[model samples]
Target chain A: MGGDFGPGITVPASLDCLRNNPDLKLILVGDSTILNQHLGENLSVFKDRLTVHHASQQVEMHESPSKALKNKKDSSMRVAINLVHEGLADACVSAGNTGALMATARFVLKMIPGIDRPGIISALPSVFGHTHVLDLGANVDCTAEHLYQFAVMGNELVKAVENIESPRVGLLNIGEEDVKGNEQVKTAAKLLENSSLNYIGYVEGNSLNAGNIKVDLIVCDGFVGNVALKSIEGAAKMISTLLKEDFSKNIFTKLAGLIAYPVLRSFKDRIDPRLYNGASFLGLKGLVIKSHGGADALAFKTAIEIAEIEVKQDVIRRISEQVEKSLTLSKSA
Target chain B: MGGDFGPGITVPASLDCLRNNPDLKLILVGDSTILNQHLGENLSVFKDRLTVHHASQQVEMHESPSKALKNKKDSSMRVAINLVHEGLADACVSAGNTGALMATARFVLKMIPGIDRPGIISALPSVFGHTHVLDLGANVDCTAEHLYQFAVMGNELVKAVENIESPRVGLLNIGEEDVKGNEQVKTAAKLLENSSLNYIGYVEGNSLNAGNIKVDLIVCDGFVGNVALKSIEGAAKMISTLLKEDFSKNIFTKLAGLIAYPVLRSFKDRIDPRLYNGASFLGLKGLVIKSHGGADALAFKTAIEIAEIEVKQDVIRRISEQVEKSLTLSKSA
Candidate 1:
């Protein structure tokens, strides 16, 4: 239900998911022909277990979020969200247009009880293990309240999925000081301080990559988070270009690379987004995970693994319980 | 002058600058003793060519920008800024705290006559040649006027240093549409449209690393720019780690690395940021380049090269002229 390209990537990903988990079933919410072309000749094998619901229209990559959702009634993403809304699917996944998907979910799925604007939380590979960076590209200009909510949601998601108790949450600021960043962070810090979450105060950019912060969740505005995500992708490309260049420089370093191959693979897996590809759109009624568009079979297989973990964890149920508890406690206090 | 590590990193970098450029002369601003310890042999060779001034205090990295500037009276960073302010030095370079350095320059060196808050500009090695990302962690939040000013400064700097006749300037946004992004981007778009600069309208994150945009400068708030920059760094590290693993897997790839060393070095040089280490703080009266604290000799050398180019091109002069021209035209219109 994400975008035009969702069916192409998702079909292959869904096949991998089915192969890994024998009991798993897939309900494809896309044009049948395109989905079939990508699913290969094993179409009949997946019959009974797989269902393809016809969806003709698609939200464009650059289409305005609201207009796309409002105008395109039977769009795959919208229909997918509706499926979740109607209690048809356990979770919905999309890799198409982020804005359109988020918009459709908000307009159709509606915000969960106390949740404001739902945030896109992705696990970034850091030196100190996995760090969850929220608001990947949902709301560009986030308020203090939005950031506070992001912290709570991020903490809950990590706790439920990763099975961590009292995850440390850090507000992404320019520097470490409580008053270091702009008005938003300064105000957000106050909310975080007052909230029930384990707020670790302000964290800087460099520390985001370092293993020192000891925090599980890092909350930031979508603009910053999105830029950070893209920057990492660009940087990875640059490094690959450099590595290839270095290997081709002469004979010695190429030989060194040979000796360093095993160590290199270990390092790659440590930071591979494929190992950390599944991004959960928290605060929704049902669990939703967005995998990278360019994810190969292995990466897609890993995404399914992540989805299984989230679904089994009853993430949405836990979130609802937490929200209810908070509301009750607030009224009592 | 910027941070405590500035001297440790800068002295060697300055020495490299002198070593590389025989015509270059250095005026070291800090404690004469420590400066001499690092530059003793080089100092004797340069003799009267190199001069060191005594400064007792140093600015800590974690200090708040305002407090650091206000309280650290005898700090070397303050002294360095004062040198530029009083016309003692043509430009300043630091690898210390960026916020404090910007604060010191704005308060001490002052804005370039008509310029507003000073912006930080770093030329990232993008797939589309070198992409200039401006306001990189300088002003976290800015008005429309600030962005317009950034465009002006970015254009002038790019033209003077990069030699791009009319470098493309794109307003960084969530989408490429004229109506996308927050209120700040919308307001800035209007200002950019009326400006004398070559504004390429809006650019999204995907277009940032790609050459498809045909833009030289990508302008955004310090928060976005900084996150983007750091994310790229993190991503590059991740990819390099992965590539190393792949190459080390077996003997064939190891042998290939040995055979392809020259080509590898060429490619490495193309993407290595150490080849372009310094981040210029634009819109200031004098030049201020902030290099990485962990910058090695190669990185320092690159920073020195940047400083030389910036100084020789008279970037400050071009920026001042552009700012003045833009302001005058706006007022008249």
Candidate 2:
């Protein structure tokens, strides 16, 4: 009902997650007939831990966010988020239209106190495991204040989820120099510097994956963050395609590929995007993870696992407290 | 006098270019002593084709654009661009500070009559050979008009240099929809739509390398473009590092790597960033190619070769003519 494959992919992913975690209970929100059809006889086995909350409406992938928000009140996405808002569900996960999901989530759950906007924060593969980047197309045109708030939230999210005492926060820019970037970034840097958070100076786009500078969290306006993230994905895809094409050029190279299959498989596993599929909607009152719309069953399960961790870590409370502390410090100063 | 290795890299690269392109002549602009030292006995062999133009000062990599403009008049970057202005050199190539090089070039050669600002355009490897992208860290904040100008310049450059009759031009955005992106991008899209150029509509970041839409030229503001370009570079580097790490994990994997060495080498060659080293400073009255700061002799020669092609094709005159035509069309409309 939400993603490209709807219940076909989501149902299997939910069942897999439940099987992995015995204590995890899941409520499938979608058209009951389709959900039940996908669930099949398995519903009888996990009937105690699983249930279906029927949602009549569905949001199209191309639907406008505002249109979806106004019209699709009973959409599976909306119903799932509503469940979270009503405290009936710990979190919600969607692989539907990003704009629609974001608009609905913000409208229903609202923002955490002291946070002006909600941002999408996701982990990207890096040399040092991964780096969490925020505001990935949530708010395209961000004020310096919004960027500073993003840093605060990103810093806190890493601390809670990654178990770091103090995560190194970096403001993304075109250059590492203090003088680089537009007015918004320069002003944001000043705000971050004065805050109690572990604020490193400016980091260039390469810092997102290169691990040249080990920054745990990188913050930028949604537009920049989204573009950078997609560009990285594009590059990775191109490399993978080129590798396959080169390997299949002739019989000799095909033999080489066969011999190197094991090594290549391990390499692919280490850099697989599915391992980092879930993107959290940060600064919201409740947790919501956005899986890639085209994600497979395994990837969706990873997203669900992320949601589980975030809920257990109480990310919402931690971010709220961090924001409140920073606001008070600024007011007194 | 510029970049990390200075004449140590530039001199050899210049000789290499001259050697490959028999008709091409090169001027080594830097401190006379160091330039001559780097040239050594090779200067005599190519004495007729290559010469050294003495510059008293060097622009520091971290120097401010404005400061470099006002203070480093005798810097190697400035002198090289000055040669272009005085009709001694057809184009200038530098591995120097980007900001300084742009500022000096803009000040010395001025802008094309109908253009307001200069943009840095570079080719990126894609599934479809390469895609030319513009405003790669030139103007941080661009108006809709500036973005339109970038499209015009990028379109013209591709046509003249790549010999594409009507290169598919795409506006880089967060999404492909008409409703996606900020006000600036939306307005720019409208302008591109109305223009006579081959505008293909809005393309997301993945289009930069994924080749899903088969765009020939992509345009954006400097900030977004720079971040995307560097992010792609970082992702490529990360993949290379991970591949090496996985292959060298143990003796068995190393054996697999040895067996697959030829295929891997070919794959690496296909995606090498050095092959796409040169970046053009478009919208300026004169041509200036900025090579990567850490480029080796071979990579730097690629930049010089790019300069040769642009000069032969008379890219500056073509862009200026195209801009004038567009301005007239808009005025009448």
The parts of candidate 2 lying over 4 Å away from their true place are A328-333, B328-333
Per-residue alpha-carbon lDDT of model 2 for B1-333, expressed as tens digits? 678998888888888888788898889898999989888898899989889999999999999999999898899999999999999999999999998999899899998887888999999999888899998998899999999999998998999888999999999998888888999999999999998899999888889999577999999999999999999989998999989999999999999999999999999988888999999999888999999999999899899999999999999988889888886467567
lDDT scores in order: 0.76, 0.91
Candidate 1, which segments miss by more than 4 Å at Cα? A1-8, A32-44, A55-62, A206-214, A245-278, A291-305, A327-333, B1-9, B37-44, B206-214, B240-270, B296-298
Give the Å shift of residue B132 in candidate 2: 0.4
lDDT of 2: 0.91
TM-score of chain B of 1: 0.93
**CA-based DockQ, model 2:** 0.87
Tens-place lDDT digits, model 2, residues A22-124: 9999999989999999999999989999999999999999999999999999999999999999999999999999999999999999988778888999999
Alpha-carbon error at A146 in model 1, in Å? 0.9
Residues B108-162, model 1: lDDT tens digits: 8778766778888888777667888888888888988888888888898999888
Output the TM-score of candidate 1: 0.88
